[model samples]
Target chain A: MFVWIILIPILIQYTLTSVVPMLISFFLTFTDWNLVGTWNNVGLDNWKRLFSDRAVWDSLKVSVIYALYSVIPTVVIGLLLALAVNTRKKGTAFFKSAWFFPVITSVVVVASIWKWMFTAEADGIINQVLGLFGIEPQFFFGTRLALITVALLGIYQSVGTAMVYYYAGLKGIDTNLHEAAKVDGCTGAQVFFHITLPLLRPTMAYVLITLTSGALKVFDSVYTLYNQTGGPQNAANTLVMHVYRTGFFNMQMGYASTIAYLLFAIIMIISVIQYRITNRDVE
Target chain B: MKKRILNFFFYVICILLCVIFLFPFVVMLFGSLDGETKYAVTLTSWFPTQFSLKQYQSVLSVGGRMSRWVLNSVIISVIPTITGVFLDALLGYIFAKKRFPGRQLIFWYFMAAIMVPYQATIVSNYLLYSWLGWINTYWAFLIPGMWTVLYMFMMRQNIAAIPDALLEAARIDGAGEWRTFLQIVLPVSKPGLSTVAIFSFMNNWNNFMGPLIFTTSEKMYNLVVGLSSLNQQSASFNMQMTAGVITFIPMFLVYMAFQKYFVDGITVGSVKG
Candidate 1:
C-alpha cells in the first residue's frame, strides 16, 4: 500500500507528461488542428504538405548543416581536450570543471554573450578586434556565416560533454596497452591512432550519436542570437524554429506538427544510418 | 631537463586555457559593477568608470517576480529530481538484481529510448499536454524531465558493479526485495545517486525550451525564461547584466561548491556505459 501510494503520483506524472503527449503527437500528425480550434482528421494532407513544402526542405537543410557543423568539430575538440587533460601533469580536476563551466551555464546566458560578440556594428568587439587587422566589420548573423557561428557556439557549449565521455573512455583503457605498445617501439601518436582510437570506439559512437541528435534539435542558441527570427531573412532557419514559427507565430499548429514530424523522420533516418555505419564492424 | 621544459610548457598552456575559461566570470563581475556598461566593447573596459549597485538593487527589488520564479523552478525541478532518484533507483535495482520475465527486453527498450532524440516526441508531447490541460502549469515543465531513462540506466550499471554475493547473502537472510534494496543497494549507491541528482538538477535548471513551450504566463516562468523576457523588455545594459548575473549565480555556486561530485557524476555515467 505504501509503495502503491508513492507510485501513483509518479505514474500519474509520467502518464500526463510523457505517455499522453507521445500518443497525442501521433494522433495530431494525422489531423488538421490548431491550438484554439477543433482538430479534425485530415489524413495524409499534413504529411503530403510536409513533403512538398519548400520551407520545410530549406529548414531541414539548415538543420543538417547545423547538426554536422556542431557534431563533427565538437567530437574532435572533445577528444583533444580529453587527450590533453589525460596527460595529467597536475590540475586535471580544475581544468575538467572549467571546461564544463559552459555546460552548466544557461544557453540564454551563452547566446546573450555571443549575440553581443557578433553584433554587426563597428562597436562590436569582434569587429573592433578585426579592425586592427584592417578587415571590414562583417555581419555575422546576417549571412550563412551566422548559422556557422551559431554552430560554433553550440560546439563550445557542448564539447564538455563529449570531453567527459571521452575522458571516461580513456580512463577505462588498461594502462598496459600503452606499455605494450611502448615496448614494441610505438610512438605516442602511433599508439593513440592504432590502439587508443579503436578501444574508444564505443564511447565515440555514443558521443557522436548523441551530439548528432542534439545538433539536429538545436533551437535555443539560434533562437536567442536571431531573436527567434532565424536570423536575418531566414538565412539561419532550422527545422525546430520552423515548427515554432508555424505553431506559435503563424497560428498553424497543424502545419507546425507536420514540420515537427518531418524533423522527426529526418532524425530517425539519420540515426538509422549512423547505427548501421557504427555497428557494421561490431558484428 | 627536456622533460622539465616540456612540463613547464604544458602548465603554461593549461594556465592560458584556464584564463580563457574564466574570462566570462571576469566579464560578468566587472559588468555587474558598472551601471552603464552595455554592448560587447564595454566588457573590454577595465574598471567601472561609474560604479553603482543600483542594478543589483533593482534586480533584488522589482525584478519581475524573479524570486517567485526561482521558488517555482526549485519546486518544479527539485521535487521531480528527488522523486526521480527513488523511481530510477527502484527501476535500476530491478534491472540489476531481480529476475523477472522479459526484464532484459524491457531494459533494452528503455535504453533504446535514450537514443530517440527528444525532437522525435516534442510535437506529440505538446499535443498530449494540451489535451491534458497541463500547458502553463509547473507540471508541464517538470513532468517530461522527471524520471529520466538515462539516469536509471546509469544507476543500474553502477549497481551491477557491486558484487552479486552481497545481494545473495541478503536474500539468504530472508529479507524482502524492497528491504534488501533499502539496506544493501541504497547505502552502496550513494555516490551514484548524488551524481545522477546533480546532473538532473543542472539539466532542469538550465533548460530554456521546456519552459518556453510549457509556461504561457510570465508569472509561471522559470529564471531562464524570466531573464529572456527581461532582455526583451529592457535593453538597459546594467539591468540585463544584473539579470544575467542573477541567473548565473545559483549554477556558479553549485558548480564551485560541488565541483568534485559533479565532475564525478558526469564522468561516471559516461565511463560506465
Candidate 2:
C-alpha cells in the first residue's frame, strides 16, 4: 500500500508527460492544425502529402547518406582504437581521455570549434593547411561538401563512445580462448579474425543501432554549423531537422507529426533489421 | 626485431589518433585567446601572437546574459537530475523488488515507450506545454524531463543485483520498507545512483533541442541555446571560441570528476543486453 502510494505520483506524471503526448502525437497525425487557432481532422491528407513530398525524400536521402558516412567510420575507427588502447600499457589512460574528451564536450562547443576551423576561407585553419600544400581553399560548408563535413563532425564526436563500448566488449571476452588459439599456432591476425571479431557481435549490434539512430537524428551540430539553416540549399537537412523546420518554422504541426512518425518507423524498421541480422550471426 | 618494429608502428598509430582527437581543443584554446585585431586578420594565424582576455571578460561581464544562461542551465540541470534520480531509484526499487498487480505489463509499457523517438512526440508536447502556458517557462524543461524511463530501467538493473538476504535481514531487524530502502538499498546502490545522476546532469546541461523549442524568450535560454544564438549574432572568432569554452568547461569538469562512473555506467548499461 505504501509502495502504491509512492508510485502513484510518478506513474501519473509519466502517463501525463510521456503516454499522453505520444497519444496526442498519433491524433495529431490525422489532423490539420497550424499550432494556433483551430484544428480539423484531415484524415490521411498528411499521409498522402508525405508520399509526394520531395523535400521529405531529399531530407531522408541526406540523412541516410550522412548515416553511412558517419556510422561506418565511427564503428571501424572505434574498434581499431579499442584494440590499440585495450592493453594495460603506460600512457594508455591519457590516450583514452584524449579520445573521449570530445564525446563529453557539448555539441554546440564542438560545432563552434569545427565551424571556426573549417571556415572555408584563407584564414581557416584547414584551408591554411591546404594552402601550404598548394591546394586551393574549398568551401566546406557549401552544398557540395556540407553533408560530408557535417558527417565528419558526427564521427569525431561519437567515435569515442563507440570505442568505449568496444573496449567493454573486449574486456568481457574470455582470455582462455585467446590463449588456446595462440597455443594452437594461431597468429595475431588469425586469432583476432577467428575469435575476437565474432565475440564482439553483440557490442557491434548495440553500437550500430545507437550510432545509426544518433546519426539519423542528428541536429545540433548541423543546426549550429549552418547557422540555423540546413546547410547551403538544404544539403544537410536531416529528418529531425525537417520536422523542426516544418512544425516550428512553417507551423505545419499536423504534417510535421506525420514526418516524425515516418522517422520513428524508419528507426524501428532499421533497428529490427539490424537486430535480426546480428542475432542470427551470433547463433 | 620484427616484433619491435610492429610495436613501434602500433604506438605511432595510437599517438597519431590521439593527436587527431585532441588537436581541435588546442586550436580552440589558442583561438579564444587571440585579440580582436589578430582574430580579424584575413590570414589569421593558428597560434596567438599575443594573448588577450577581452573575449572572456566580455562574455562573463555582469551586463551580458551569458551568466544568466549559466545560472538557468544550472537550475534546469541540477533540479531535474536530483528529482529524476531519486524517483528513478524509488520506482526502480519497487519494480525490482515489490510484487503487485500488472507489474510486468506496466514495466513493459515503459520499456516500449522508449522506442518512440522524441521527435515523434515533441510536436504534441510543444502543443500541450503551450496549452498549459509553459512555453517560455523553466517548467517546460523541468516537468517532462524530471524522470526518464531509460534511467529507471538502468536503476532497476542495478537494484536487482542486491542480495535478497540483505532485505530479509533488514525485515527481521524490524525496519520499515522505507527504512530498508533508505539505509540499505540506496547506499549499496551508490554506483547506480551516481551513474544516473552524472548522465542526467550531462544530458540536461548539454541539451539543445528541448530548450530550443520550448523557450521563446532569450532570458529563459540555457547556455547551449544562448551560445548558439550568440554564434549567429557574433562574427568574431575569438568571441565564438570564448563562448564555446565557457559552455564546455562545466561538462569537462564533470567528466574529469566522474570519469570512473562514466566508464562503469557505459559498461554496465551495455552488459544487460
Candidate 3:
C-alpha cells in the first residue's frame, strides 16, 4: 500500500538525519575520532575533560548569560506588545504587522542590518545615534559590549514571536472575565495582574521554553555579526557555536559531541525545571 | 477623559515600538540607496544625494555572484517547499489517521529529535553526508530536510482535525485510501500545506549554517551565506545593505502574499496547543 511509501520515506529520513547521528554522537562522545582517520576509545575522557575545560565553562557561562538576557526581555516585550496591539482601535493591524515584520524576515538580514548599525565607525548607526547625544563612536562588537549587543539584535527579531504567542493567548481569553473584573471594581492593572496574567501561564511557559532554548542555540546573530570568529575575545561564543567550532573547524569531533550532549543536558534540565515551575500551580 | 488619555498612551507606545521594529528594514532599504559609494560614508545622509542603482547592480553583478547565489537560494527553497510539503503531509496523514505497530514510538522519536539542537547532529551528519559524497551538492540541502519533525507535527495536527466522517464517506464511496487522501484530505489541508511550505521555504531560504558547513565552494552558496561572505568583501556599506534588501525581498513577498496563513499559522501551529 501507499502507506508503505509514507512510512518508508519518513523512517529513512529520520534514521539518516536524527537516529543514526544521535547514536553515533553518543558513541563519538566516548571515542576521539577525527573525520578521516581511525580513532582511539578514550573512555570517559571527553566527559572528564568537560568538567575541567575552562573553554567549556566559559562558553557555558556565556550561553547561560545569553539565554537569560535574551529570553526575559523577549517574553516581557512580547507580552507588552501583545497587550498593546491586541486592541480594536484604528490601525491596530498596522501595529501588529509592523511588530511582526522582523519575525517573518530572515535572521541573517536582521543581523546584517544590526552589524551595519553596530559598526565601530563614526558613520555606523549606533555611533551616529550616540554622536547625536554628544558621545564618541563605540566599538559595539568589542568584548565588553558584543554579547549584549548581539542579544539586543536577537530581541528585535524575537519580540515579534513573543507578541504573536501572547496575542494568541490574549485572544483565547474569555471577554466575560474582563467584564467580570470590571464589574468587580478592579482597575485595569489589577485585572491584568489577577486574571489575564494567570490565564496566560501556559503561553508564557511555552514562550519562555522556546525562547530560552533558542537563546542557548543562538548561532546566526553572533555568526553573522562577527564573521564566525565568536566575537571579540570570545565573549559572544555560545554553546552551539562552541560545538560547531570544536567539531567542524577544529576537527575535534568527539569532544564536540561531548559539548553537544552537555548542551542537550542543559536544555533538558532547564526545560524540566521550567516545566515544573510553570505546571506546579495547576497541581 | 482618563480612558481617552490611556488609549492615547497606548497608541504612542505601540506606534513607537512598531517604528523601532521597522527601523532596521528602513535602514536596510533607504540606507542601502542613500550612500553607495566605493568608500560609502553612510552617516553623511539619511537619504541618497544621488539616487543610484549602483549597489543593486553590484549585488546582481556578474562578478559579484549575487545572481547565482539568489538562483541557488530559490532552487534550494522552492524544491524543498514543494517536496517537503508533500512528504510531511503524507507522513503526517499516517500519523494522524492510522494506528499501527510502533506508530506511537516513531512519533515520539520525531518529537525528541525536534528537541535536540541542530548543532548536536552536525558532526555525525557531516560525516555521513561526506561519506555519501553529497558534500558541495544541493542534495546536502535538499535531502536532509525532506521531512522535518516540526513540519510533520504541524501537518499531523492539521490532518487530524479533518473529520473522520469525511474520510469514511470517501472510503464508503469506493475511493481507495490514496484517492481519499488526495481528493479530500489534501483539499481540506491547504492551510496546513501552505503553513509548512512557507516555513520550509523560509527556513531554507534564510539558512546560513547549512550552506556554510556543507558546501565548501563560493559557487554553491545560497543567498544568505553568499551575502554574508560577500558582506565582508563588499566594497562599501551600501553594497551590503543593498544585498540585504535583495535577500529580504523574496521572503517579504511570500509573507505578504500569504499573510493570513502566515499569521494564522503562527497563532495556530506555533503557539502552545
Give the candidate order by descending TM-score: 2, 3, 1
Measured as a fraction from 0 to 1, the native contacts recovered by model 3 come to 0.63
Which lDDT values do the candidates have, in the order given? 0.77, 0.86, 0.82
Off by over 4 Å in 2: A271-283, B37-44, B268-273
Off by over 4 Å in 3: A134-137, A270-283, B38-43, B62-64, B268-273
- Is 1 or 3 the stronger prediction by TM-score? 3
Per-residue alpha-carbon lDDT of model 3 for B1-273, expressed as tens digits?
999998898888877877778878887787677643644434556566777776776668776688888888998898988988888898889999987888898888778875677776778778778888988898888887776777888889889999999999998999998898889988899988988888888888888888888888889899888778866675466777788899999989988888777766675434343
Candidate 2 local lDDT, B1-273, one digit each (tens): 998898888789889988878878887787788875434423357678888988888888996788889899999999999998888899899999999998998888777776777867789999989888999898888898888888898899889999999999999999998999999999999988999999999999999999998998998899999989978886577877777888888889989999988887665445333
Better TM-score candidate (2, 3): 2
Return the clash pairs for model 3, or none.
Answer: none
Best by lDDT: 2
lDDT score of residue B62 within candidate 2: 93
- Worst 10 contiguous positions by lDDT, candidate 3 chain A: A274-283
